[model samples]
Each structure stands twice: as C-alpha cells, then as structure tokens.
Target: MDAGPFFHGTKADLKVGDLLIPGFRSNYRPEVVMNHIYFTAVLDGAGLAAEIIPGDGPPRVYEVEPTGEWENDPNVTDKKFPGNPTRSYRSAAPLRIVAERDDWTRLTPEALAEWRTRLARMRDENAEIIN
Candidate 1:
C-alpha cells in the first residue's frame, strides 16, 4: 500500500525486513526497520513496512511535478540562476531511487577526508568575513 506523501521516495518492492528512516526532515529521527508486512500481527510501532524496489533489479525513475506551493514556504532559499530569475529556474527534476543493500558501514578514511575537505570549503565560502 502506498503511504502517500510521507512515502514519496519509497519504492514498491520493499520487503518486511528492510530499514527506513526520514531522510531529509528533522521531525523524523532514529532510522526504523520494517518487521512485519500485514497488520494482522502485533505491530512494533517502529519502522514502516514499505514496498521499496528490490536491489536485484533495475532502478526506478520517478518524474517530479511541482505543486506550485514552494513559494508559500518561508524556508525556501532563493538561488540566482544565470543572473535571471524569470528565465532561469524552470522545473523540478525527477527523484531517483537506486536499489541497494541497506547496511550500516563506515566510510573509508580517504572518502571521509575528501568529504571533510569539501565541507570545509563550503563552510569557508559561507563564513562571515569580519574586518
């Protein structure tokens, strides 16, 4: 069963033993894994039993359509595109979910260092330069 807006990026082939979490939001915390399929059994009240696309098959592509509500959100950050806001931002891109094993593993040191450097650069660029 489709879980609606909350399950926007959810896949259809996800099984009962899979893990899920609120990816980009703050209200959702502590990743939850699925433990049951149907509601006939005792519910753990933890993760949801979503139907995500299995990792053994091709990735599913979802076309994103704008709902014309982003402008109403106060947290929306306006970005300058090509020096022209009118002729710049056109449409939203599709959100894709590739099937993969949901295992907990630490990133390699080299990769972590690279990410740290990238983050440092971003922080430097956004830092307030005081006289």
Candidate 2:
C-alpha cells in the first residue's frame, strides 16, 4: 500500500495516517537492504493534526485525498499481506508510489530524524552490504 491513509482490517471509513519510510523491509534480510517501512498515523481528532513523530518539532498538516481501496477475503482473516485477500473503500484514488512522502517529510521533523538515525545505524552496521 502507498503512503497516506489506510485501514487495518476492512474499515475504510475510519481514516488512519501512515508513514512510508523507504529503505527498510518488514521481513528478515540484510540490514542494508533498501526497502520501505509502513508506520500507522496516530493523533487526536482535536487541534492541529500532526504526524506524531516522537521528539520531533511542531506538528504539521498535509492535504490528503482520501483515496484508497482496502480489501480482504471473507475466508481469510489471520493472514497478512503478500497473499492476503481483503478490501477497503475510500473517497479518493489509489497511491501511485509506495514511497510517497515528500509532503509528510516536510512536516514532521522528529519523525523524519528518527527514521534517518535508524537508517544511518543500519548502514553503519552493515557496511559490507549495499542498499
């Protein structure tokens, strides 16, 4: 799934923010592998909405199109992505890039720093591999 909004189960009506971190994979592999990490958006409905990057600067806002289609096979509930079947409805369009975050990156500084530090450490630890 691309960045922006996406639901966990089959609920599309509930919009949830997401952090699309590039160069990190979910599965076990070389630490230097360049993949993407997906982070769920968390924040209160009141006041200005921030991406909630811990120890970051002030919260920033971004324009979301509310475009996504999440789905799941009724028979499959325990399985996750890669081969899972499910569906989600949205009021916008699908994400063209799984690593779309220029808008989000410009907003939450702390979140961005956290991601950067982690990536640097990974690179430092896995100097033998190229991401």
Candidate 3:
C-alpha cells in the first residue's frame, strides 16, 4: 500500500522545501492531537482532503516524501475499507514537500455540499478517529 510517490493536500501555502510534521489536532476530531502526518498515493484523494481543511485559498496538493517510518493510516485501513485502497499512510516523522501539484480534479459544488453534510452528520454522531 505504500507504493507511493506520496502526496499531501492542504490549504497552507507551503514551498517545495517545506516540511509537514505531526503533533497537530486531528481534522476529523479536533479534540485529539495527531501524532502522525498523513499522505496518500492517490492525488485526487489528497485534493479532497485539502478541500475539507480550512485555508485562506483553494486547496493544494503537494508531492512529498516521508522522512521516517510510516504505516497504514489506521483511520481508514480496515476501519472504513477492507485494505489500503486509498494508499494512505501516516508517519510520526516529518514529510518534506517536493513540489506543488495542480492537476488533481476539483469537486463539483454538489459533491462539496454532500461532503459538508456528511461531515456535519459525522460530527453530530460523534464519529471516532483512530488517531
């Protein structure tokens, strides 16, 4: 599942040499501080994640490299899908940004709306985040 030229998506205006580290609040469960930085091999999947996170501008996808050991993102690995179909992983170490990618597809308005609704419902239901 780690067959990646990995990518991370976010709204942060980071440069090619920037590093993404862990120890931040979980985007899904804000009350939990994340110990791992997440990434995926699927570009558009990162784009979708970027869209979910708040930012000053449109979401951006970045080519990245994990600086240390990583593992299947427990949040999705068997908890949601049967395996790592998304090719998502997380690391306690830093991820170095290699370049910015602009080719990922953006979600349509309807799709975005549906996502927002789903997120709200998850919040209402007290959905759990593995990390």
Candidate 4:
C-alpha cells in the first residue's frame, strides 16, 4: 500500500494528542487513526509520528526520539475488519507520503448495489437531477 504523504521536522507545535481523534472509541490503534480520517477526515497520524526535516517530494528518514510510550494494547489489536487490517500501535511507522486521487469505483459491493437501486428508483420516478 502507498503511504499518502510524508512530513518531517520537529513539529513541536503539534501534539501527539493532536493526532488523536476526539471522543475516540476504538480499542485498535489503526482503527482509531482510520476513525480519525473517516469521521474527522484528517490523515496526520495514520503512521508513525516522527521528527525530521522534510525534503522536496519525500522526506529524509531521520532518527527520532520516542516522545511517549508505545503501548501494545490487545484491546486495540488482534482484531479483523473488512478492508483494512486491525489497528495496532505496532503498525505505526514514519514514511514518505504519496499523493493519488481517490477512485470512488472501489466501493463495497453492498454500497454499489444500494447506489444502483437508488438510481434505478430515481430514474423510474423521472426525478430531476439536482446538483
């Protein structure tokens, strides 16, 4: 899988807790991060939080001191989801970010079926297209 984007340098202004989604209810670390993106729509901490100076396109890997304890909570790990792996603190890593456009055609079968049904009903009703 492609790492989305890479940022480096000491973002002292940014807090680890800042990467955390507020009112996070997941026991999994990755899920927590995904929930942060799915609900809050942010991708700052999907991977490891590191301290390095960013280069032109990708970032230069640098040794970063651990800011806090990396906990391996089973309550958050050892689970399975449909598409993505279960989130774990161990899965955290710092990597270069890659940019790509979202392909909406990759949606789940159930979601596609629902959309098809909705569209068919709309077509039958001759609903005016609203944008």
Candidate 5:
C-alpha cells in the first residue's frame, strides 16, 4: 500500500477530552467526512482543536498545526452542496487522525451499509494517511 503523504515536524500531544472543532471552511459532520473520504493528519504546531472523521463504526480525529501554505487537493473538487460550499485543501505535510474503536450499535442497518461503502471509496482514493 501507499505510504501516504510525507510531513515532518514535532508531533502534538493530545488528550481524550480535547474537542475537534470544525472551521468555518470545514464540514465537520462525521457521516459527510467519511462519505467524502476526507484525510486528516497529526502535525507539529497543530492547534488544540482537531478535526474529526466519524465512521459508522468509530470516529477518527486528527491534530494539525495551522500553516500559511495551502494547496488544492487534486482528489477532491470544490463541493457545492445546496447553499453550502465545501472547499478542500492539501498540505505537503499532512497530519494523521487517530481514534479509538467503539461500538455504535445504534446506527441503522442502512447507515452501516453506507459507511462501509464510503470507507471502501476512501481506501480507493487513498484518503487516509496510513502509518
């Protein structure tokens, strides 16, 4: 498998209680993040607030430092969802999202199916940073 994006720097320390707030430019919904096959990474200087990608099974959260540099991720185009427009960016040094596994038995069967389908797509797009 592909090693994934390369990012060098100090790693940020995180705790379980830390919250991953969504930026104005971000669509922080768990379902959407997984379905869209978004990637998150851990980088030095990343803020205390992290971004989260929630799958039906579990949620993955990433911590990344804010940088002045920004580039368009070729994997995704500008998304126009009704009144909301979601933009995607790529970093030369992408951070990784680390999350714990938990049982989300409350999800409907349809939702579970969708999550699996999206996860497959995510794998195909290499949207995740595999260490």
Candidate 6:
C-alpha cells in the first residue's frame, strides 16, 4: 500500500475508530452506488471533496487507515490525469477513522460555488461513472 496517512472526506459527523465502508452512493453522483471507499494522501484534496458534498452539515476531513487492499481510482487517475498524481485510491474495504483533521485549508465561498456549479453540470449531462 501507499503507507498512508490516508484521509476520507465527508459531511457526516463521526467518531474516532469508526469504519468507512464501500457500497455507498457516490457523493458526486448520488444515483450511482460506489464500489469503493475513496481516500487520498493529499490533505487538501480530501478537504476539497468534503466541502463539495451536498449537505447542511459542515465539511469534515478525517485521518484514516484502510483495512484491506486498495487501487488507484480509475475515475481520476488515467482518465482525467496522466497518473495518480492526485494520490487518490479506492478500496472495497472499510477505512478506519483515525482522527479528525481541523487544519486543512478551506475553500473560498466563490470556489465552493464554482465547484457546485461544475458538479451540477455533470449531473445534468448525465455523466457516466466508471463503476
């Protein structure tokens, strides 16, 4: 594995030692069930994900550990970039929440709004999830 210091981003309130499992709907595409629980080695990347999640709760980024094997996220890996420069991975296993990270940089309101707009456009276009 990447010997991570991994992190998962979400708007869900959680406690230390909680497990994040796969099979949940994609926060980016709610109609598509995610086959893997995604995490990143980059702190800000996770923070970006958390911020864009649709919810009324505050976005949260958590330090995490994977319980099983993981692979590069095909969605953003070669598909969107040349490599796993995003440091993103997905596992068909549970990710144990280690602790909450409060020091991640937050996006500006304008940046957040822009992201929401881009996501909404993807949804309206009926973007395809790689599964």
After superposition, candidate 3 runs with Cα above 4 Å error: none
Regions of model 2 farther than 4 Å from truth:
1-107, 127-131
C-alpha lDDT (0 to 100) for residue 12 of candidate 6: 95
Point out the higher-scoring one by TM-score: 1 or 6.
6
lDDT preference between candidates 2 and 6, better one: 6
Would you estimate the TM-scores of all the predictions? Answer: 0.22, 0.22, 0.95, 0.22, 0.31, 0.96
- Model 6 Cα lDDT, one tens digit per residue, 4-117: 899888999999999999888888789999889999999999999999989879999999998988999888999999988999999998999999999899999999999999
RMSD of 3: 1.1
Residue-wise lDDT of candidate 3 within 1-131, one digit each (tens)? 46688999998889988999999887777778998999999999999999877547879999999898999999898889998888999999999999999999999989988887888888789998877
lDDT of 4 by residue, 14-115 (tens): 333234222333222212322221110112322122112221332122212223333332333343334334322322323222222121123355754665
lDDT of each: 0.26, 0.32, 0.90, 0.28, 0.32, 0.92
* Clashes by residue pair, model 5: 41-95, 41-96, 42-95, 42-96, 45-65, 46-64, 46-65
Best by TM-score: 6
Cα lDDT over the full model 5: 0.32
- Position 122, candidate 5: lDDT: 63
Q: Which residue runs does candidate 6 get wrong by more than 4 Å?
A: none
RMSD of every candidate to native, in Å, equals 15.3, 12.1, 1.1, 15.1, 13.0, 0.9
The sequence of per-residue lDDT tens digits that candidate 1 reaches over residues 19-123 is 332222221111222221111011111012112222244222222223321121111124322332221111122222223233223345585476556645645
Candidate 6: Cα lDDT at 114: 98
Of candidate 4, the 10-residue stretch with the lowest lDDT total is 33-42
Distance from true location, Cα of 78 in model 2, Å: 15
Q: Model 1 segments beyond 4 Å from truth?
A: 1-102, 127-131
Q: Looking at candidate 1, what is the lDDT of residue 53? A: 21
User: What is candidate 4's TM-score against the reference?
Assistant: 0.22
